[model samples]
Target: MKSNKKFYMVREDMLPNSIVKTAMVKEMLAGGEADSINEAVDRLQMARSTYYKYKDGVFPFFNAENMNIINISLLLRNVSGVLSSVLNCIANLQGNVLTINQNLPLHGVAYVTLSMSMEDILVPVDDILDKLQDIDGVINVELIGKS
Candidate 1:
């Protein structure tokens, strides 16, 4: 059987304190702010069990070091130059497009899926999405996956 896991993008302030603290602890350990898990948890006054429980589950969306590739789905008005404009926007943001798939327009709307490398992107992913959404004839932009 396949695992039925799902992911969501949530505001930091809305997360429970334990989950937030676990992320902080991981950051501390990775950044050398704390020498070990024990030290990191102690510094944060968080329980070791709590850290272990959430360590693998919580991650910051804008962590450039860990997030290298991302896939996005877009809805576009079936007008000339719309797709070109979208690609230009991604290139302007320094995102390397790895793959692109566009379905035939149906009812004046086109669906496009793009897989791109975020390694060279200077701006945050959210900013990239915002810029894409701002383009004329672009109906919507959604970040569907990341790795």
Candidate 2:
């Protein structure tokens, strides 16, 4: 039988102890708390086989190290407050706007490109895009580049 499974983003406190321990063990290994997998599992009182089983299946919601720079292009309606709304959305997500380039409005639409630092963004890029799409006067949004 073939099965399709759905995953969820749940709070840490809601997870089972074993799953939490699996994440802990993975972190310990990544942070060099232990020289080897065996040592890390031993220190955590978890089995090596169990750790390996969940190693690839579990990870933290956000890894700050991966937060870098991203450039996005947007086509917005030529209207007052449209640009402000976009910037405000980024700010609300804690994204730092590095540079903004906007083309003059033509045919009731304006093209905008923004470069931002993602070091402090609370959620993933996809979530940010979804929020931007929810705002009025935003015609379209695309992730042009990321680093």
Candidate 3:
């Protein structure tokens, strides 16, 4: 049977608060931050009905565990050792770097794209992005694609 369901990648800020809250409630439950559905909804000030309505449809992209390969784009200051630091961060998280494409520095900034295997990643993909952003000289980090 063919499924007609469609998926889209949307920025969180552009989505309705209900959908976002629904995802949050689900995470709270999964992470044991909320013991029950009622508690989860109440903690977020969301109605039980709203939670049920969107629960099956809303999911965080980074939570897709079956995805094995992820491509990320980074903007970094054109300085020595910045790119190396980013690679080290990924390695430390158990992600295997598969490919890297870096552009020449333009106006003191460089754009780099990396494809990595997530098969052995020890942390959530979102956490990897957060760590990359925290690295010195990294101007921006964005998840470009995943497979």
Best by lDDT: 3
Q: Where in model 2 is the C-alpha error above 4 Å?
A: 1-67
Across 1-147, the per-residue lDDT of candidate 1 in tens digits comes to: 324788899998999999999989878877889999999999889899999999888887756555489999999999999999999999988888988999999999999999899877778889999999999999999999998
Q: Compared with the true structure, what per-residue lDDT tens digits does model 3 show for residues 14-86?
A: 9999999998998999899999999999989999999999998898886645458999999999999999999
Worst window of 10 by summed lDDT in candidate 3: 59-68
Candidate 1 collision pairs: none
lDDT agreement with native, every candidate: 0.90, 0.87, 0.92
Answer with 1 or 3, whichever has the higher lDDT: 3
Output the TM-score of candidate 1. Answer: 0.55
In angstroms, what RMSD does candidate 3 have relative to the true structure? 12.0
Q: What is the C-alpha local distance difference test score of candidate 3? A: 0.92
Error of 1 at 141 (Å): 0.4
How far is 90's C-alpha from truth in model 1 (Å)? 0.6
What's the TM-score of every candidate structure?
0.55, 0.55, 0.55
